[model samples]
Target: MEPPSITSHLAPSGEVRDIEKAAHTAAPISDPSVHVPTDTVNDDGLPPLDTSPRGWLAVVGGFACLFVSFGWMTCIGVFQAYYGSHQLSNYSASTVGWIPSTESFLLFLGVPIFGGLFARLGPTVILIIGTILHVGGLLGVASCHTYGQIFATQSVVSAIGTGAIFVAGTTAVGTWFHARRGLALGIVSAGSALGALIGTAVIPVLFDRIGFPWTMRAVALTYFVLLIVAIATTTRRPLPADHPHNPFRISHLAPVSLLGHSPVLILAIACFFYFLGVFIPYNYIVVEAEDAGDGVRSSNNLLVILSATSTVGRVMPGWLGDRYGRFNVTIGFTAFSVVLVLGVWIAAPWRTGRIAFAALYGFGSGTFVSMVPTLIAQVCPDMSKLGLYLGAVYIVIAPSVLIAQPIGGVLVSAGDENSRDRYVWLKVFSALAMTVGVMGFVAARASYQSRVGKGKVV
Candidate 1:
């Protein structure tokens, strides 16, 4: 079946709601059993969108959930540097690097399953369980003194919670808004910027003031409170109305088969290469700077600088994406990221140069976590099936994060661990990976335009 034209959902006279609403009249609400629906699709068979109070509330819920999950995930560099000098210092960078890589790997690795679970169980059930596992994992990590203990608690169990809330919160927002989706999702995703900024800035200070174990305890408490708010606020759909089944049957969710679609296939392949090296700066900035004779404090400052710029990166680009086409804005920023990695990160070795690179790279890569879903929505066959399609895309790319971080660690060795490695090869590798990522997106754009045609909804 040919998918409904993007035009089908627009209001009369071809004006999108961002400007003028087409003639749309919502149903009467006199019957408590039959709730009124706004943002209804004209004839696409997709679920109606929600841009009302309930929609924004879902966005808030998404914001809190992501702050703990993807937000904290971005701070892995801070932890990596600290671990190298302190906890797992005895192990080589490659071996100790497995902890964060594994945690990142598991978090994304479980996205497909978690997406399925989100469809079946809804946000509250999934988030409640995620909170328990996540908080419990943090508490466990506090007492861990050995590599195995930390790996088990931080990488495995905690990662599940992190992935769960991320999927639940993200899908909730995805289903909520259409006209303002880029801006709304950007705001929801900015929660990660908040988390990354706070975590990067504060983790080092807290470590000194309270020590590692106590620091973990404090972070865990923060997670508990924020996650509780997410649980209370997020809903699967704007309700009094529920998805035909609040407890949906798993089989009804989009299946892995959707990956075979040409656009999705191309996009997933692109993400694989992009993700493989996209995190190189994030995973290695502190260590790379420190080895080059940048002091620990200076290196930490670089991390903060990167996170701070990411705040602007996430929101501003998204606002532009809403006004311009999402594809144009995303592709433009993505290509700019390739330039930053090669031109700035590779060629510049001075203190001033590295700081500049941090700010630029952070902004350039900021849209990725927010806009990938918006892109996915463009090609999705059905909105209700989005969770599975999103899972498929991310899972295809999960191995990249798993492999790249360890390889980056190995690349830190220039003949010996003690060598003042400049990481030339790693820089080239990251650029190349991101380059392939760009190529993939360009191809996906072509495929989507060919299939869906021009002037389609972004």
Candidate 2:
């Protein structure tokens, strides 16, 4: 049988076939869709997965983890708006921007360490500890009276907790699903959208009715209950104690070695630039609307529309990524975000246009946020080093996140608050940053395709 063609749909058999399939499947370094012929070794080298009830349950756990953890990230605009008018009104926009900026900075900085701990301590323990810190941080924030106090509680403590859950929760999903990894991760990403949709609406109501302190306490309580379910359900497949390639081995402590990989380097740069603008809409659209004289109702409604469309963006792209290709879909939508930022968001002069801008931008940027991680995983050469690679990428991207909103604040602060020109500059900056990021992604995809040859699903 003339050595089964590389593209043959035949049942994969023998070591040679496995090697060929893996080679054909490999696009670059991050996305290793290595196909093992036998139903024994999985792509990541774990034993056969139980993609059944127990396994699916773990995915649910991951969904819950992301929902709770990333709620604040997506709904940060609400907090930004609230602080601007209420507790921290005395502070400058640039100073207020630091709260969310610090949260993101710590979240990225801690991902590697949290990833490492997930392997060592497992998801349950790590999640439990994270839940405590997150809930406590919320309670602390409710009672906080000073800038320093809010910074310590909301920015530092709460952020660290959110980071721990984020790294562990997302990683747990991979343990259960291999072939459907993109879809699974995509569903998990939707949790953030759902959380934002619900949390943003709820926070405003609670603030109006119950006040900030009790509202936070109520939110914390809700998180406590959801976390209990997460702790119960999320789990991973353990490597056999005698397995030669121990993932928990000490030598794997640092992600430094991955810094040398060309794909990793390129993607890291792309991520840094891409993230520079991803959070702008999420953090500033409401404030921008308010400044444009849209009033509180219109501004809040825009956020709701953004959150709803983003949910679709997060879910649909994941399914497409699994069927088509992660990089193809991700790169396409990333470029689309530039158009939304510049064309839609920047041009919105009236309330109706602003609403339209929110929905369109939300959809485009939603995919941008949800699909990038899976794209990184698709290009990763070594499955064992996935966490480390993620860590390295975040390290590059974190500082951009730290400074992006604050810079937007500075831009707006530099000119008249009501001047449409000031906000226009912010949009221009966002669109350009995303455009540069798209080029980087295109370059990486093109470079990989050239090496692999055409007509393959990279």
Candidate 3:
């Protein structure tokens, strides 16, 4: 039997023959006799689907844990402002300011190590322990008499709980959503922003009416309730019994490949600069208002406004990210931040300028935070490794968060011994840092686009 002619397969009646011919034409590009798996078949063979109600329960539970943990972390800015004036005024701004930043760093950086632990132990077990630690840390803070004591209890111990909750909660979310991953993760992450808004507005008002101790006690009570809900609902989905291995092996611990990959590396650098600059506004807004002749009450209200604006910033960008591409959205907002910092913030001479800066920078930076993890998700293929990767990134940037406030404080202290010109220097440096961050984001985006063109899977 003669082999079929290529043109013979072109007839409308020769559908099967045409498929055979097309297959034959492509065969010579590879091994002709070897059977290659179809893309659909390969995808079908992926890890089994999660269908259990328990899996979803775990997801909601995890979100609750996140709401509490991130809420408190975001509220640290409020606490920093409060303690700076009340209990820690005797200490230099640099010294007292380091406490909350350090707490945030530890809270974020400790996640991967704990995430690995959570992977090994059940999330439920980890979350329950974390809840106790979280409440206890806050209670300890309510009882603190000195800056050092507050640092120990609130910064170090509470940070440990925050880390535990973050890793577990984020991993839980990762486990639950695949197709709707970006939207689901966005909603969960929004909890932190919501917490910030609620905490800043509520805590300050509570302090005004009830006193700091009672304010903290109320926060502790709220956390206690949320943690209970978390424990009751949180669980891990059933997967093949592969004795939960640490997501990071010693080999894998050398820094994620994404860091080595130029795109993710640049993004990390951008994050560092973004954090360094953006936090200037967050840390100094209260102080700025006070310097601008606003009273403590008005300063606290500005912080509340920033927090509320940021809550909207966080959610809106996340929704836009789903449509416009995470990288594009991140870069756009980052650039907007740079402009707002320099133009509206640096050039404004009066209270109006300061207030405008707060609103604009608050919204811009909030959008940046909302989009970062989504961008990370786009670059990372394995959902199981999300926590590890995020943790690693935080570990790298932890120093930036640690130093930004103190550095800004030092700048302020140096410019005017009385701290009169600190806000000006803060505005300047913030603008510069954001400019660098935007450049880094642009480089990362270009790198990402290049990789996409190569047909390397995102």
Candidate 4:
């Protein structure tokens, strides 16, 4: 005979129900989707909501690390401008552009390895190694004068070093806090803007007064001292022995199974498109202005202005995202970026246009950086697996970041000067890429809603 049905014969058709509901009277049904944050538990724990001094210090260390690594990357426009006028003047724009392009790629490229090591070995050992490479690479650039020499030291060597630092800076912060993560990351990301401002404002002045060799030496020395702070302060809370992320089993790094999550796959593709041309304003604003018959040199200060606004962008939006939905705020900011690129960037007169776009776009684009980590947090329930999620996102976006920049350089070459027009194609390309990214975000949210039956976009 078959096993008796868990259900009972009911007096009315309406009384018939799931046997699980009948069992619920004895034991409540458990919801698998309800994730208890690591904060509730001790080992993973996030140090009791991360209000402690050590947690804040980790935030400080993350700021310093990013200031020296990724934040410093924002100033790559100055290098692009300088190379065109100086040592690498012989190379074509697209060819010369490969240096910063590759450097940007390398910064994100090492995340999976670095994230794994960070979870396994803790922040100290990996940070020390990153410090050596980053410091050594910058100092090496001081002696390099030829095309091959600069590319080797700055692009390949220093870039790989910064890549390591970027991972340590971001993931260290990730492991430290849970509830306040968006606010903490936003504060840390402001360091990027501060570094960009210093790099844009200070690097040019240093170049004018001291020349390249000594200028490089000064930057290297500064980075070494700051990196020391990061190594000392950034701390990772231990994950439980059984946690998949505790020792970060290399076998599970960048798990291919994550793509099975509909939201993650859609969002990753969206971010790739978003990043595709987003840096055009940062990397080529100075380059484009410099090529103009009108004094391009006058517009160099715009980068500083952009960085200043970027500081506001990074700090404020992150806090807002915590209060509001991360996805909602991010989508709004991204849409604004599309409007800024298409409307303000392409239409304005030379100097006025550059200034308006720089200030507005800087703030608009800055939110994307700060909010991304928070967005990724939603994809994985376990805070212990944060490193893996971060690695997956970056690895997906890295190749696009690598290629988009060189493509921007090529677009600059395609513009026409005699018509008093340039950067037209570049402007349209950037706007279109952002448009698709916004569409993807919308679709991703729709998918999330379909699965969860959400009322809000979050």
Write the number of the candidate with greater lDDT, choosing between 1 and 3. 1
What TM-score would candidate 4 get against the native? Answer: 0.88
Q: What TM-score fits each model?
A: 0.87, 0.88, 0.82, 0.88
For model 1, give the 10-residue run with minimal summed lDDT: 23-32
Please, what is the whole-model Cα lDDT of each candidate in the order they appear?
0.77, 0.75, 0.68, 0.75
Cα RMSDs, all models:
6.7, 5.1, 9.7, 7.8
Error of 2 at 378 (Å): 1.0
Residue-wise C-alpha lDDT for candidate 4, range 143-237, written one tens digit per residue: 98888888888887788788788777777776666556678888988898999989899998899899999999999999999998898899865
Q: In model 4, which residue pairs have backbone atoms overlapping below 3 Å?
A: none
- Give the per-residue lDDT digits (tens) of candidate 2, residues 1-458: 55333322211233233434343222223232444232455555544543445567887887888888876678788989999999999999999999999888887777777776666788888898889888899989989988999999988898888888887777776655556667778888888888889987778888899998999899888888888888999877564343333347553444655556566678788888999987888888899889877777668888888998998899898778776767788898988888887777777756777788888878988897787677666655433335656776777888998999899899777766556556777778888888889988887776555544575455
Candidate 3 TM-score, true structure as reference: 0.82
Clashing pairs in 3: 58-235
Top candidate when judged by lDDT against the true structure: 1
Better of 3 and 4 by TM-score: 4
Model 2, which residues run further than 4 Å from truth? 1-50, 240-242, 245-254, 416-420, 450-453
Candidate topping TM-score: 2
Residue 213, model 1, lDDT: 99
Please tell me which model should have the higher TM-score, number 2 or number 3: 2
- How far in Å is the alpha carbon of 202 misplaced in model 3? 1.4
Q: What's model 3's overall lDDT?
A: 0.68
Off by over 4 Å in 1: 1-50, 238-254, 415-421
